[model samples]
Target: MGIKLDEEKGLTLLEVLLSIVLLVIILTSFASFFTQSAMFVKKNEDKLSTTQTAQQIVNQIEVSLSKNDVKTSSVCGTLPCLLEKKELSNLLGSPITSSFNISAKFADSVEGLIRVKVSVTDIKNPENSSETFTYIRR
Candidate 1:
């Protein structure tokens, strides 16, 4: 009798199929996670961009308010209209929107204090909009 070995070292068909199914499940979950993460990042970025733009708008308005230049116009207009689209675009280094819509609504105005509601909307997507209220003093 020559050398006889009792060893079976190959995976069965069932074992191979089960392992493959497990790997597929794991990989699919990871892929969905990565996809969700990417979406979150994009949405966050858009929000940030809109917020920054809104901040800049508020700052400019505050400055004008100090100089006694803010108007009660509902829509932004040229030169003396309180706000202008081209002017805002010029102030931003990289504008997220080619154009924007600036609208103002007065919440309350009294002596030494004015409550103004302003909305900055991206022309590309209205959902990418920001609103802030600023108080101005006499």
Candidate 2:
């Protein structure tokens, strides 16, 4: 017998096209979300790296101060001790590019207490920066 007119079971061409369009829209939104997530992860990683570098510098300063006074220590011989980009690279034993900056300073208001401020900044992205403040006895 011939096929009946009302017995068709397959999807229509228009329905298939509409489904494909919906699928494309969903996939595009997911792609955008993934891209944004990746960017956020990268920024956070930069922040963590800068923070760890700054902390390492502060630790080194603390250790040096423990062994010797700030005025006579190799790390810093004056109240406002600053390390150039090259020096920072040398100190870390790695190539710290010009995109990064590090600084250390002391507070003058307190006696017998040296307030050490260490800051590391990413030149490319100013928002990605880390600073550590420590108080050590001189």
Candidate 3:
């Protein structure tokens, strides 16, 4: 009877250890899944923000071109030029808090056509960045 009781106690100990191991495995998998899901959400948000910034820059370029005031000498510098980042931000009624670099150059193929490039870094995430390049003709 004593030996039989000892065998039953040992079996119970083994069952407890196996239960703990199974629980650990399950919890680890859940943690991995949550981490991956969070990363995916963050990537998607960055992409959306980049697209929005590109669209806003393109619109500003179009408006500047429509005014027909952009100077041949102001391709981006030295003269009454199409709007720079600061000017565009002001025109768009947004604060110029973002680090945006804007450049304009005359297009090689078309007279009175300008190529504009806007590079901006996300305010919330400086490491992630985007660029918009567009052509505008007077």
Estimate the TM-score for candidate 2. Answer: 0.74
Q: Write the per-residue lDDT of candidate 3 for residues 1-138, one digit (tens) a residue.
A: 344554443456788999999999999999999999999999888867776776677776686554344442333433334555666564545545545444333233356455666666666676667777777665
Runs in model 2 deviating more than 4 A are: 1-7, 73-76, 85-99, 109-111
What lDDT is obtained when candidate 3 is compared to the true structure? 0.61
Q: Which stretches of candidate 3 lie over 4 Å from their true place?
A: 1-13, 72-84, 90-111
User: Candidates sorted by lDDT, descending order?
Assistant: 2, 1, 3
Over 1-138, each residue of candidate 1 has an lDDT whose tens digit, in order, gives 866556657888999999999999999999999999999999888878777766776666566553243333334222223334554333322233435676544333556465656677877888988888787674
Could you tell me which 10 consecutive residues in candidate 3 have the lowest summed lDDT? 72-81
lDDT of each: 0.62, 0.73, 0.61
Model 1 misplacement above 4 A: 1-6, 71-99, 105-108
Give TM-scores for every candidate, taking all chains together and pairing residue i with residue i. Answer: 0.64, 0.74, 0.61
In model 1, the worst 10-residue window by lDDT is 72-81
CA RMSD (A), model 2: 4.0
RMSD of 3: 5.1
